[model samples]
Target: MPIEQGGRVSWGVDHLPYGVFSRPGQAPRVGVRYGDRVLDLAAALHDEVFAAPSLNPFMVRGRAAWQATRALLREKLTNDMAVTEAHLVPLEQVRLHLPFEVADYVDFYCSLDHASNIGRIFRPDAEPLLPNWRHLPVGYHGRSGTVVVSGTPITRPHGQLKAGVFGPCVKLDIEAELGFVVGTPSEMGAPAGAFEDHVFGVTLLNDWSARDIQAWEYVPLGPFLGKSFATSISPWITPLDALPRIPGPPQDPEPLDHLRRRADWGLDIVVEVAINGEVVSRPPYASMYWTPDQMLAHMTSNGASLRVGDLFASGTISGPRREERGSLIELTWNGNDPIKLADGQTRTFLEDGDTVTLRATAGSITLGEVSGTIR
Candidate 1:
């Protein structure tokens, strides 16, 4: 049997979890992952056989429904239920939505490696990290209105691409990242919630990039069209409450007094990326220079209100290792050297028809996977 966290069962190999939207004739609006199948959450909820008083309150609301749904799944699997006559649905039948409507979106460049690689290329000999980097979580507000679920195709965007020698480019690229969704909202004046409550869940994120276009336009205010094109996320969201609460040590060199969080503020979720069905890059969530809680605290420090459904992506969590790099620009060193894949195709940046998938799993519990075909 799996262990429990905060009175809820910890997700494990025996139990798989998923999210769902209601439909007629569906067993219930819930999805359970047993091996390869995506069990319907809606079906489980309606069935009196799977009764749980704890999950009664969250049966309707989208976010709460998912949370309660997972909690019960863990219980059922751990206890080993005998109801084998489930409505068994195909994994493809699951209609994956945003999991929750996003109220806001924020992206942070918390990886010093990513910042340094780009900074060195742009401003050689300059300090790679900004002075405020260690003191706070640096971020840019994103377009929540544009976020989409996995399997969505993103068109190569058009924007300014300024290259001194080569003139400019219409090229595009992808950035691998771990996205955090806000579980609870903060009051107008009250301080941000502790690390435990601020972060609700984790998902794989693919932040598409138009490198050439970005280079030309990102002079004064950072990324614009180069980034705003389209961002994709995996369908299922793994609530933070479901994973093991094993806390990691504080980030290196210790954070500023105000930014420092409790010892267990961060999780060690693994993040990886694939291109054309090939695993090109893989890295642990621990590679992040900062934690999601710190980012939340910093965002709310100025009294900026945080609302539920807010999506905060820990900026390309790149590490010092070469294979751990997250973006094409960084991986290829700004196109100076292209990465050759086993598939006989070399990619300095993303190409037309290239499909990229971002997948993350902690132990046997997956946060699901997000994939997009570039056109």
Candidate 2:
């Protein structure tokens, strides 16, 4: 990929996101994504760390190593492209696998718009946000085993609709969100200013939800079967060094000292949601009420240790406008208002054959898209 005069491509060398790839007879190994190709990191760098099937080995090396490796990759890709060209593999000729092994999965309700919309839809007469919503980043533990790579087929999950009722999930939905990849592990205590140090990268995530099932079981505790069925994420993990940070949305009542923002970690990536090839929503990430740094601080404030490949996602990335809603439940107003597709078919939720794709971009650099079809 040729770097333009200003030094950026649609998917540029500056954004050399990493992932694991395999050819027909080869074992999976780490690679970096260039424009239309994957740079075999193991072959090009001659490092056995990149020869590992997952990114965990490289990620556990901590921040200093991470930064040094990134700098080296840029130098080689830009100035030494002629020598490194032989290791470049076309993206179409390889299979992309899950980039890292997930140690734990946590999803946060960080979007005020999504939370408010959902509250209004379900509790029309009550307050839109819960009492403790603004006070902290509300979240729930999710099943890490179910997390899968992009393009994996998602079977519609089944759960109890009411008491003693069980069947296929009729109100299947998608939550367009961004996931944070944890690199360095930390012992107990809060990581207030260590967001960039510990978080290695970001990835587009689609938290597939069963609205009816979620509504039924998420009363006292939180999500269970409705959410754990499947979660899809982009194959490429864009390093934090590549994303441009900006000021996040202002919090109404200031957060506590522990939850305070130490740095401008608010990412300005724009996320686009498409259903069956038609663009529907373009949810802005900058609009999220709670920043990832705060979420990290809150997660470890209670003596929770961070793991090498732990993944935490910013729950549905919805905006204030109707077109900016991230989930189908919010877009269609809990099935009361159905969205019309280009094919003239109105949809309240995902059908068995429908496909959902989420793409995101920060300025000129396009993040790898997470796409999945219902089976």
Best by TM-score: 2
Residue range 193-213, candidate 2, lDDT tens digits: 489889999999999999889
- Cα lDDT for residue 237, model 1? 64
* Total colliding residue pairs, candidate 2: 0
- lDDT (0 to 1) per candidate: 0.69, 0.92
Could you tell me which residue pairs clash in candidate 2? none
Q: What is the TM-score of each candidate against the true structure?
A: 0.84, 0.97
TM-score of 1: 0.84
Residue-by-residue lDDT tens digits, candidate 1, 1-375: 334544543345433544543334443343545544555544555664222221222322345555565666667655645552264455555555556667788999888778888888778788877677767778998888778889888887765456543432456778888888776677787567675565666778888888887777777998887788798987666666666545544566687666777656556667778888888777666767777778877888777877767889988867788888888888888888888899788988887788998876665455678899977
Q: Rate residue 234 of model 1 by lDDT.
A: 76
State the displacement of the C-alpha of residue 216, model 2, in Å, after optimal TM-score superposition: 1.4
